[model samples]
Target: MWKPVPLPYKSDSLPLPAIPTAAEIRACTNVLWDGAHRIVALNEDVVVKYDGGLDATEGQNLIYLERYAPKVPAPRLYAMFEEDGKTYLILQRIPGVPLDSIWKSLTVSEKNGITAKLIPVFDAMREAACPWPDFYGGLDGGRVHHWLFYSQKKKDFKFLGPYYGEDAFVAGMLQNFRVSTERCERPDFKARFYEKYLPQVLRGHRPTLTHSDFHQKNILVIENPCPDNQGERSFEVVLIDWEDAGWYPDFWEFFMASDRNVFSFCDEDWFWHMQQFLEVWPAELGVMRLFEKDMRGH
Candidate 1:
């Protein structure tokens, strides 16, 4: 198993862009999205995402996709930097509104049309195999990272294992859970949890490049203009937010997609459409959720 490493650079050693303050970011009238740790602002054709000490892996992931998985429709990364404990990623803004904003308003036929477009994209991602079978986290050739065990306050930015097989990867996930909780100090409890639940939930599965958070919000949809009195107006689906994307077990995508945090509002039709591309294991998700509750002592 791979051990966690401290962030290599000190505060002063980071090569970064001019740090933009909260006031400066807030002043931007073209704010695209605002969340807890990151704020995305647009300036004409460029989109700048300012991460307030959350995660910098997305920028690197974008670069990796551009080079390795060019067929995947993602934003073009311009530049990235780490400054004053914040990470800034400058990217070419893809033309589209988030699917979530317009999903509820779309007719059933329109919704099916979007789902049809996504089918090929999901197939391509599943077909994009990693060069090394052992590599299980983050971009294939970039600095390793894991979004599942991430915490802003702890600053536990160390990369997890590039495990050789499914078993090792499952073990790595368990280790990460231990590290994230106070259970790290209790070996007996850890041992029991591992022996009891791990076997039930962790099954042998093939690995694939998964956009772990593949919910509506992370997807962008754009309607193309019909020219020369053409046929139907086509829509393009662009996947965004590669922060949580990585190579993982085939089931990882389904498990993460099932997360309520990913889908804020319940859309039965949208849910049904996603299942067509991938299968969800409710048994596995249930075990995982139980483990999470135990870790948090809830």
Candidate 2:
């Protein structure tokens, strides 16, 4: 919902350190993450993430956060450019561990402390004024990046977004749904039922900013001992992976966070804690689960 401004990239500006080759990144010893892409720590202060399949919007989303939602703690993007069919993002190397790494060992008080700190981070996103009334999509009118918006077949894929209102947003979803139906060998008959149910279920919602990939793994936290209070610790939380961050229906954050695949654990404790911060939309989530089932032809 933050007001987005144009990026300052110019053709004449030099991209620092000269974008590296895939071979160079593979050879780097300080590699931090290696999955869909490679995240290499160039030094103590700087790191770079590069991949041929990376979304062009990832760096742009970081820039959006830096400018509009300053309070939302995220990595600082130093440089971003594409070379040899790969996108590279130079970022500030944050000093902390991913929340999921320590979730199981933390005491009850520590968990509550972390959860309390996270509430304000989300509030900063939710409380920001919408850039345009009823607009839903990526920053600066880019395409929406939710998992539901992705397709395996690029030739027939439609990247729908920047919808003007809830109606348009729902229409866009249905359009993508219809495309998926074409590929299904045995389409669910409930697709027709959902075609009517979805609009009503998703209707009358206002646009809100969402980190669509909200999960413990993307959250970085550092612990500090409180000098004045005995045995007390303070936590600093920073959100990472902004590729999926954008404006969407208010319920999208809770819905996306609750996804079991990304939530890291099927633990009911984690689920209960999430409800404390994210606005719960039981009906919407239930309906969307059905929508997901039909879309994937499960």
List runs of model 2 lying over 4 Å from the truth. Answer: 1-27, 151-154, 185-188, 225-230, 261-267
Candidate 1 per-residue lDDT, tens place, 231-294, comes to 4445789999888787887777877777754244363567777777776676777776666566
Tens digits of lDDT, candidate 2, 1-298 = 4443333332222234564555665577997988987798887877888874785588888877777889899988876666676777778889999988988787778888889988898899999766787888987667788767765344746466778889988888876777666656456466567787789889778889888889889999988746225465667899998887888999999888888632454654777788788899989998887787767663
Candidate 1 RMSD to the real structure: 6.3
- Among the numbered candidates, top TM-score falls to 2
Whole-model lDDT per candidate: 0.67, 0.77
The prediction achieving the highest lDDT against the true structure is 2
The lDDT of model 2 is 0.77
Clashing residue pairs in all predictions, respectively, total 0, 0
